[model samples]
Target: MSVIFGLAAAVAVVAALGVVVAQRTLYSALALVANMVALAVLFLTLDAQFLAAVQIIVYAGAVMVLFVFIIALLSPGAQERLHPLEARVLIGGLAAVAFTVVVARLTLNGVSVAASGRFYGRLGPFAPVLVDRHGQVQTLGEQLFTTFLLPFELSSLLLLVAAVGAVYLSRRRRAS
Candidate 1:
């Protein structure tokens, strides 16, 4: 168990570092995929089966595909060589550090699963909220549909809008 946890953590960290440090965008994206897969495996080892499934399905599957699609649409070729001047590299590093700090802040202060009432907050209105107690799917489904149906439907709508926006943005633009 500890070995699995350690290995997953190492893999995730290294892959994430590669995502940041790789010169090629495609290599970075591949590294991001590796990081996501590592995270999914970590979730599985932690017995967060649903979370692991969602991680694999949403992030590794859907979101990565979207990123790849965008990369393909935007890039004219396989490799984009940057003339790495000191100012640009420094600015890039600063931006990366800022992003890292933001993520670290969110992660550290984020809700503790060790605390009592921690459900999947991302689902928002479509809340299948389980706090390690009262967590049966049927019971949760009843609660979501009864008390939280409105939010669930809204979230789905938001997803639909995002999908449409992505499709629109990816389409070839006409000359004005």
Candidate 2:
């Protein structure tokens, strides 16, 4: 099951990536939606049902709609290649290096808390009142709501900033 799921995820990622590379903005947005859906599925397979649902609801549903809307509104048209070949090569090399570093971190270190033993083995393997007591959202929520509520609320304020920035950017500028 794991092997099959992993292979499916790999295919989804590759297909979405190819779509992103394709010239059509609409197709690229759809491809991003596909990638997000695949990620949600992957989350479900890892027993993060809440996260999976939230991912689909928030990112795949809301975010993708926003992306498509923005693409339509902005209408960034296809343009002739502007960058010189050398600049493209330099950027490609930088991107490759970044990708290599990310893959190495994922493969060797593993990003999850379990692999890192974050919480420093405090979160037990199993406990009631949580999913296998994996201590992900539930624990994080507990800590945030109880101990770190202020910071959590503050984080939501960042969303307001994002909204303001979006309005400012989308609104037409007036002549001085």
Candidate 3:
């Protein structure tokens, strides 16, 4: 399990970098799909089967397919290559390294604190009881519909707007 988790983590990191650094938009979108798949593997390793499935089905499947289709519709030209020693590249690399270090330190500290029973975070209301009774997926569905329905509907609305905008832009490009 640990080995699988480690491998997935490594793949996730590499794929995330690929998403940022890939030259082509299509390649970046593919990399994002890889990253999402790796994240699903990590979630699976953590025993969150529903989350893992959603990660793959919703993110890797639906979102990535949309991104790829957009890239295709846009027909973007090749990105200009930056020099290896460019100031922007150097600064970005340094920032990424610093961010990674800070995240790693925080994660390690959080794990140690939790393991030592020193982390006293607020507990969710009725989480355990709901999970015990209805299971994770059912509990999540209930909460999503009842508690988070507005936000969920708003997000769907936002996605619809984005899709409409994409189609409008693509049509405008073709018309020009």
Alpha-carbon runs more than 4 Å astray in model 1: 72-143, 146-150, 163-176
Per residue, candidate 1 scores C-alpha lDDT tens digits across 1-176 of 98999999999999999987787777788899999999999988866666788888999899898887787678544565666686888899899899999998877656465465664557543233453555544555776688889999999999999989878877745422
Give the lowest summed-lDDT range of ten residues in model 2: 119-128
Q: lDDT (0-100) at residue 120 of candidate 2?
A: 44
lDDT of all predictions: 0.79, 0.74, 0.87
- Write one digit per residue (lDDT tens) for candidate 3, span 27-137: 989999999999999988876789999889988898789889989898576566668999998999999899999999999998998799864677563455557777888
Q: How high is each candidate's TM-score?
A: 0.61, 0.69, 0.71
Candidate order (lDDT):
3, 1, 2
Shift of residue 46 alpha carbon in model 3, Å = 2.0
In candidate 3, the residue pairs with backbone N, CA or C atoms under 3 Å apart (3 or more residues apart, or in different chains) clash, namely none
Q: Cα deviation of 72 in candidate 2 (Å)?
A: 3.5
State which candidate has the highest TM-score: 3
In model 1, state the lDDT of residue 92. Answer: 92
Candidates 2 and 3 compared by TM-score, better number: 3
